[model samples]
Target: MNLDSIKQSLSLWPTELWLLFITLLGLVLASFINVVIYRLPLILRREWGETNLPEISLSWPSSHCPKCKTPLSWRHNLPLVSWLIQQGCCVKCKQKISLQYPLVELAGGSLALLIAWRFGANLSSLVYLGFALSLLALAVIDAQTQLLPDKITLPLVWAGLTWHWVFSSSQMFDQAFLGALLGYLSLWSLFWVFKLLTGREGMGYGDFKLLAAIGAWLGAPALVPVVMLASISGLLVALVLKLNAKWQGQALPFGPHLVIGCLVLLIGGQELAGWLGLGAWLEITSWAF
Candidate 1:
């Protein structure tokens, strides 16, 4: 068959098949992300003198049980299925594994499916899928450890700017640059003001960087709604934790809420703006850019 005919034939495959493939790919990525979420912090801690350990890179040490350090075979490393098969325990050590493994896999699969459903087979879809996955990893890491490494956040900022410059006609590079600057400054200014008045840090510098990365992707027009949605969600979560006595007077990390907001804007920013009676504002801002 001619190349065009082959392309047409491939396109004719069922959407279900494509979605299933995306979901499986997402699960695999999630497995890797689990390793990242678990290891990146330790690696950083070691660098910062918080821990004494041999140099460990993400790729050097194969997947293994933390308690027993037994290298996992392929059967034990099959993402969610393996976890289920083992009943969330190590096959050799019988030690209970954290539910985070399966949970991250499930989230990754769900996000991938959603991206596929929304954008179909397109470059934009793949780009957004990657962004969503990064956010997922950052959210989980920050929630567990209250830290967002510059390694991920800095690369994400550059990636966003590069993506728009190369692929997007609607969003210009300057807009992304301004969005990043403003996004970082907004939170950073708030943090200092709050600290100056109350003598307590309101949020970490990592939160600022995360928002800046989001702005770089979505542009300045998106910053307000993202922050608004994030603040509301964060407040609700904090209140819930406080009521449940789970807060323990510790400040909750804001990165997850920011990730949620960024995802919301990514998936349906125009609709959200319309719902909030800010459709005109977004339109005006788009025109200005």
Candidate 2:
């Protein structure tokens, strides 16, 4: 069959099968994201000052049980499937694996399914899928390690700019570039001001970059709305954590809240606003691609 014929044949597949395919794709990607979430922080810490730590990169030190260091074979390495098969315990040491692995995979798959449903099976689906996953990974990593490596955030910022410059029909590069600048400066300014007032840093530099990436992808008009959404959601969560006995003293990470704001704007921007009676406010901000 010609390429066009193949495309037509593929497009005619039942919606269920397409959903399954998208979910599997997302699971595979999320599996790798789990690796990054676990290992990236170690790699960064080693780079910073942990000279005594063993040399390791994403490609190096192959996957293994962190507790007992047993190598995992392909059979036990499948994403959600393997987790279910193994019942969340290591084959050799019987060490319990964190529930996070399968949870992240599930989140990734569901998010992918939602994106495919929203954007359709097109190149935009692929792009936004990757973007959303990247944000998810960063959120989890930040929640755990409280560090947002420039490695991820910088690339994301640049990727957003490049996407607009190359493919975006309505979003212009100038808006993206300025969005990034304003996003970074907005948090950075707050950081310094809070520090000046209390003699302590209130947030990390990673937050500034993460917001910049969001702004870059969503545009300058999105800055205020995104921050508002992030702050509200983040503060609510923080309050909950404070009320909990165990989490009262722990520092809360803001990156995840910022990620939530970005996703909300990216996925449900106009419709969600309208539903919540923020249509006029959202329109006044003109938050759109």
Candidate 3:
């Protein structure tokens, strides 16, 4: 067969190699998100002087059953497969698994595949794949722990800036730079204003950084719409929780809201922006008007 035919044949194979790669990649990321979800808060706390970094390295301790303290085996650690096989129980101690493990793996893999399909083979796609995974981990970690780790959020910001400079030196760079600045400043200002009025801390600084990361990937113009979308989603979530009586005094992390907003922007920001006529509307509605 000719080279084009050979390429087409591989592309048409029953199991695309890229899909398989993403599936395997998802499991690996899920395993690590488990670690990040658990440890990121601790790391953040240490950095903020709220707590001392434990003298014991978090990693020296192997992955162990929280219930039984029995070390998990490689067989048990096989991501989604192991969870299915073991019926969501510890193989060694038979302790019931949280089901979070498989769920996170599945989410990560599915999202990765989605991104791959959307962007295809390119530098933006790769960075975005990582971005989606990081956001997923942050969203889950914040939901469970009410904390967003600087370790992850900061690196993401840097990655966004660096990725923009490396791959897209023109408009992409401008978008990323403006996005990062606007994303951070807008939230940071809102936080202070809210605190001044309400006499309560409204959100964490890490939330700003997460938005900044979004700006880095998408651009500054995305900030307004993203925040608006997030606000609407958050209100709905809060209302649901309140009605359900699941809303204790516990503060909801804003990270997930921002993640959802960013995802929306990533997929359809331009269309949404055009439909809303956001720029012109803002100009007309400004106090100067």
Candidate 4:
């Protein structure tokens, strides 16, 4: 069918149907993202070390129970349902499975449904959904390993700039470019300054690139809110950890907080800014520019 005909047919469907479709799509993608979260770091490490570690790619080495090494059949691979069916245990070995799988899938599905509802069934929704999934994957990976591979972050930066340049009407190319520049520079400057003052590193270069990618997508106006929100979230988490005696001297990953910040900004940035009284400051700054 022609594109117009397809659009017309889609328009006829109920909103719930579209939401369900996107949620299902998100669940499937989240399963794949699970593979990525587990494998990408290993792949990067192997590549860096120039070692042969059985050549594991995302597609290679079919999904299996890590404890049992048994390849999963279709029945066992269903996103959130299969885990519930088996009661969160490997069917073969009866070993308990990590809850991460179901949680990630649920998060992915919810985010997809939210995007579908917010942006409708449009290219913009699809693109932002992809961006949100990437951020989710990055956050989880960083939380576990304290690493954000360039494989993901670098492409995200390029994709953000390309999306804004080609598809964005609200943000100009110059704004996107400046956003990226400032996002990276702002973090980079802070990194060095903090290191100089405290003789310890506060954050990593990956964070700078991640923010740059965010800036490219949301433009320069988003940088302040994103950073502020991330900082506040991080501080709260840190305080909780400290109070609970779980705080370690080891570095905590900041990517997850930043990802949360990006999502907040993307979903309701203007409303949030207005509520916080930053809207006036933003307007005054724009006037100065």
Superposition-based RMSD of candidate 2 using all C-alpha atoms, in angstroms: 2.6
Best by TM-score: 4
Candidate 3 — worst ten consecutive residues by lDDT sum? 280-289
Instruction: Give the per-residue lDDT of model 4 (tens digit) for 11-107.
Output: 7768888889988999989988998999898898888895966579988899999899999998999999999999999999999999999999999
lDDT by residue for model 2 (17-39), tens: 77788889999899889989988
Model 4 regions more than 4 Å off: 1-13, 50-54, 282-289
Model 3 lDDT tens row, 1-289 = 7746655654554436665666577668768777667666766677668664653234756777868979877887887888898888887788798877778888878777766566554444456878888998889988888777777888888988887787665766887888889889989999999999999999998898898888877777677778888998999988888887655856888899999888766755455655756767434433110
Q: What do the candidate models score in CA lDDT, each in turn?
A: 0.86, 0.85, 0.75, 0.86
Highest lDDT against the true fold, candidate: 1
The per-prediction tally of clashing pairs is: 0, 0, 1, 0
Question: In model 2, where do residues sit more than 4 Å from their true spots?
Answer: 1-14, 170-172
As for candidate 1, its clashing pairs are: none
List the lowest-lDDT window of 10 residues for candidate 1: 3-12
lDDT of 1 by residue, 102-190 (tens): 99999999988988787675555667888899999999999999999998998999999898887667546777888899989999999
All candidates in order of lDDT, best leading: 1, 4, 2, 3
TM-score (C-alpha, index-matched) for candidate 1: 0.91
> Which 10 consecutive positions of candidate 4 have the poorest summed lDDT?
280-289
* Candidate 2: clashing pairs of residues: none
